[model samples]
Target: MMKLSLGPILWFWDKCTVFDFYARAAEWPIDTVYLGETVCSRRRELKPDDWFALARDLKSCGKKVVLSSLTLIESEADLRGLRRICEQDDFLVEVNDQSALQLVTAREIPFVTGPAMNTYNAATLKVLAGKGLQGWCLPVELSRHTLARLIQELEAEGLDLPAEVFSWGFLPLAWSSRCFTARHYNLPKDNCEFRCLQHPDGLSLRSRESQELFRLNGTSTLSGSRYDLLRQLPAMADMGVSTVRLSPELQGMEAVVQRFDTARRGKVPAFDPLALTEAPPCNGYWYGEPGMDRVARTNAD
Candidate 1:
């Protein structure tokens, strides 16, 4: 069976809700759980110590916990946090930036490269693997044909790092120093008072025709259409993707997991996973099509 991984929480929830969510997730049948702040560092609902504690607790519950770092590094303070996470020995670290790759290299630590890291070719994969990269999250924009080539190239070189795909969730396409959520509320980035915590998922962006286009988080912009790959589980497994990642959201996540789990096991889910979300569903990047195109599953029965 293909493994399931819970990606890091991208939204800023209250401290209590964050804790309670993970407490429940620890009992899920997932193989790996990624924890930490992968977005703006100022969304400090959970401190480093708190994340480490949660990582430890999840590890105790028989789940593998991987610590994630920030996607954008604008300040020395963010660098300090990256250093702290890379230096830790208790859990594995997922390097989200080039600077993080440097730190992990210096420490001689094996790390997973987060999707935010730009890795598109076999040469880049080989370079990262040389620097202690044990696994990598495929860049969200790359198509399956490109990935097939890279995997084949790696296999030709006898390289054995695992390939994990971002199977479901809104695609986080870009990040910036300026917080869009703060700007949306007519607030300055510094004095914004953590306004992003107000939206559990993210503030949605609509087109001129009032159709949903994208979602605005603190510094990141995501696709309005949720990425759904339950129907593609067989193809992903055939591609030798060892793990499938589910990015955390506010609602119906347990059912989401169950749906993917059932689908991966060749059982039809009670509900259509694609229709469960308010936004339109997409699996284009997986098939090398436009990122927003909905490709119906030919194998779905």
Candidate 2:
């Protein structure tokens, strides 16, 4: 069975909301939960101690908790934070940056690579597997065929790292040093006032034709369409995906978890649905098409 995972919260929420959200999640059917600040370092709604506390609580509930590192580390403060996560042996750390990878691998800390890591082939997976890699998430842009090929190659070489797919979220397209959210508000990067808190779901960018194009949250830009793979779970299961990750949203998360849980348990076809009821659902990257394009599920939905 392909286990369901809740990716770290991508949107900025109040500290109470984050705690309350996880408190509720402790009872959800999710098998794995990733905790951390993956975007801008300025948003300090939760400190390192806070993340550790939450990880302990979640672990007590029988959930596998993994601390995730920042995608774009820019300073010594960020490096120190990554060291804290890598040095700890209590939970697995998700490496999203090259610096984190180097630090963790050099220390022989067993970790997993996130979608942001530049792991596109079995050769990269092989190298990381030797460096204490417990698992890895495929880069979001790779297609089902690509994953199938990589899996086939890995198994042929007898290097079977657990495979995870970014099954649902606003596809994180890229990262930049200058926060786009701050730019949206015409505020400089340093004094941006943590304005990402205003847009919990991210600031949506649309083309002049009113087509949803992208979303800006802190230093990252995501696709405007929420990439959904509920209907494609059966196919992924057949392809031997070990896990499916759903990025956290402020609202409707419980229902989203429940829906994926139900579908994964039965290996059944599911109607593609959006949790927050805004952007149209997309699965184009999974089908080797432009990520923004919505590819209909041939078998269902």
Best TM-score goes to which candidate? 2
Q: Model 2 over residues 124-183: C-alpha lDDT tens digits? A: 899899999999999999999999999899999998698999998898989999899988
Q: Which has the greatest lDDT?
A: 2
lDDT string for model 1 (1-301, tens) is: 8899999998989889999999989877888999999989898878999999999899999999999999999999999998899999989999999888889999999999988898988899999899898999899988877777888899999999899889899999999998999999999999888988788889899999987789999899999989887777787777788899999887878878888888778785655834444788888887778888887666531
Q: Model 1: which ten-residue window has the lowest total lDDT?
A: 268-277
lDDT of model 1, residue 97: 90
TM-score of each: 0.96, 0.97
For every model in order, what is the number of clashing pairs?
Answer: 0, 0
Error of 2 at 237 (Å): 0.7
lDDT, candidates in the order shown: 0.88, 0.90
